[model samples]
Target: MPTKIEKDSYTGTDTTGHEWDGIKELNTPIPSWWVWVFVASIIFSIVYVILYPAIPLTDSATQGVLGWSQRDTLATELAVRDEGRADITASISEADAAIVEQDHTLRTFALRGGAAAFAENCAPCHGAGGGGRPGYPVLADDDWIWGGTLSAIQETIRVGIRSGHDDERYAEMPAFADMLPQGERIAIAHFVAGLTGKGDPAKAAAGAVPYQDNCASCHGEDGTAVEDTGAPSLNDAIWIYGSDTGSILKQISNPQHGVMPAWEGRLDPVTIKMLAIYVHNLGGGLQEDAGL
Candidate 1:
């Protein structure tokens, strides 16, 4: 059993006076201010429990007077953002879809916007400035295997050549090795080179008849290119593939069929229109005053 010690009148406080031999224990009093603060804190806790979400219930937390929630806050923020974006979306549409890429201002807008979009989407294959990769076509020059006019380019973008579009531009440059003798193939290649002023006149004269029958369908009667056929003009010295003799010979032996994916379904109409205008203005845009 624990023994109770009487109060010491000298120290003026209650205590268990029993102690180790010759040592006395002292009783200390807490300050009034500290005690008052402790009491106030207890009272504040009680008030908080009643007015705010403090204790957990069976299925949910207690609802606070503020009525604040994370989910509700997010929803309100999204509504505000949508309201702000409405105008930008409307402006994109109002930029004119049928500008024909002739208006300088519209064309400039398209070029800037389209260049950004192209770098984001097409730089992996077409290069950052449409400078052509190992397999893709260059878009910065006048050389175009599939026409260069605004409508023509728009059509190409809508339905790519050799792509799975129903109305895609389609052509097959046959291998002369199978159709004509090796010498005749060489002669035709020489003729094509001559059209670009790069071949011997005698070889060109020798291959002229063969070139007229086989190559004229797309390259045109004078090798000037039939725009409707998507054949590049040979007289301009701008070769879509290459102008080197070896490259020409290889192309003559086995023609190239470049494929570009159709972006009509992938991009919106306004975006596609902008892209067409941008590409037209890159090197060869038909003037509005031109009877095109």
Candidate 2:
């Protein structure tokens, strides 16, 4: 199916001598506006090549009139950002314990920063939200194996629990099986369970003295925990290892020591403060809106 038109008609242009079903087609030149647009595009592309970095060379790109680079832009942005943080670093580092304790806005910002660092560094063991895993102590609860006080928490963060660091809170829960008779170990386990309202009274009464002598120094006088010693409260249902007889026996036989990384070097002081507050607020520490 082909169509043809007269050689010289509307615009004095030649037409093919062919037709399909008596229908003819005209051969007209491109419109003046369209032709001009096409030519302008080619010229604009050449100018663009000269103005911007569009052409690729052997090892580098063509240097345009404006020498712009992604690295330079990033560096400028980072410099501007760091300038702001630099001025605040002193105030943040020297922030009083009381100010951190009372200030909500400061606490919120610090917590957010700490949360990000915790997700990246502490989440592997403590979990993303400080919920804690099997061996890791839960930071999201009031049951801190160590003290829940801000200072105590900060010290713990600086030194770490059971760390060989000079100021680390040191005291291993002795394997009672080595010191006490097997029968007495059972009795103590029963006593410990009884403290948490899980064991018989008669057995617990017999093991009370042993519990006091062997466990009280760290676990507190009433099995309520010693924040200074990082000892868990036997009276509470929360157990670092487990609450079962077998678990208790194992704990009694071998002391459990869980390690948390000292975040001092890894994160800034302000960040650490924020994280401590964030974790403390999770379930353990003082709250602003709620009355005790």
Candidate 3:
């Protein structure tokens, strides 16, 4: 059933003991270098299996000879990084927030730390750059509901505004929908809108008497809101809720109050101080002596 092996007459090469359509396959041995390389690869694979975690078992992989793990290496790297920053962190922890600005190194460290903290904690409500969201007040503007000095900012961060914290800066506007007639509320809304040049002048004039009787106590007769009461100035164009007539009406009916969480117990004091500094430097912070 088998053909006898023989050397091909044309090429002088030995043929395998088989033939197909008068052609025979040449019996050529694999190269020694290639065979040795393939054998070496098998040996290397065996060594690797013994030296490193390879085979998967029921609960975990096999513990290799070295016992080294990626998680352990990462933990070691993190510990080294923490050690490097320990001195700066400790310096900030001990330094007074107000005096931190005097030291360039401390201030730089504080700004970096404060930025990271703000992103982690405050970015959800106040926005990445403190530009504020719809219901939240802008931190990068001259308008401030509470005082805006460094001390004031620090205090606000510590206690928060309208938060449940005992020390929170609290302010409340009566829901006029429950107190005043609908017509009077509308007129008051118009008047408030007119303060920023946005509503009917005649309606605003008609509403002046009602506004004087109801709003003048907290907001001055000239509509300049009293800072002590945390009332925003109506004379200015800046409106926390909005400046349009519809927005004014909604606020007059049922006022929306903003709340900030107390950071005193949550974040460290040095971090809070750093936050205050970062917020105050956002182009609209006030100086200690600056009037509200």
State which candidate has the highest lDDT.
Answer: 3
Candidate 2: residue 194 lDDT (0-100) = 79
Could you give candidate 3's per-residue lDDT for residues 1-292 as a string of tens digits? 4588998788887888788888678888889999999999999999998998889999999978989788999999999998998998788778777778668998888788888888899989989988888878788899877888888899999998888899989999899999999989889888988877879988888789999999988887878987779888888867778888789889888999888889989998888989998888887889889967
Ranking by lDDT: 3, 2, 1
Clash statistics: count for each candidate = 0, 0, 0
- What C-alpha lDDT values do all the predictions have? 0.73, 0.74, 0.86
Candidate with the larger TM-score of 2 and 3: 3
TM-score of each: 0.65, 0.75, 0.85
The TM-score obtained by model 1 is 0.65
Please report how far candidate 2 places residue 49 from its true position, in Å: 5.1
Candidates 1 and 2, the one with greater TM-score: 2
Error of 1 at 211 (Å): 0.8
Name model 1 segments beyond 4 Å from true.
1-85, 91-96, 100-109, 288-292
lDDT for model 2 comes to 0.74
Model 3 steric clash total = 0
What is the C-alpha lDDT profile of model 1 across 120-160, one tens digit per residue?
A: 76678878777778668777676667666676777788887
Q: Rank the candidates by TM-score, best first.
A: 3, 2, 1
Specify the poorest-scoring 10-residue window by lDDT in model 1: 283-292
Runs with alpha carbons beyond 4 Å of true place in candidate 2: 1-65, 199-206, 286-292
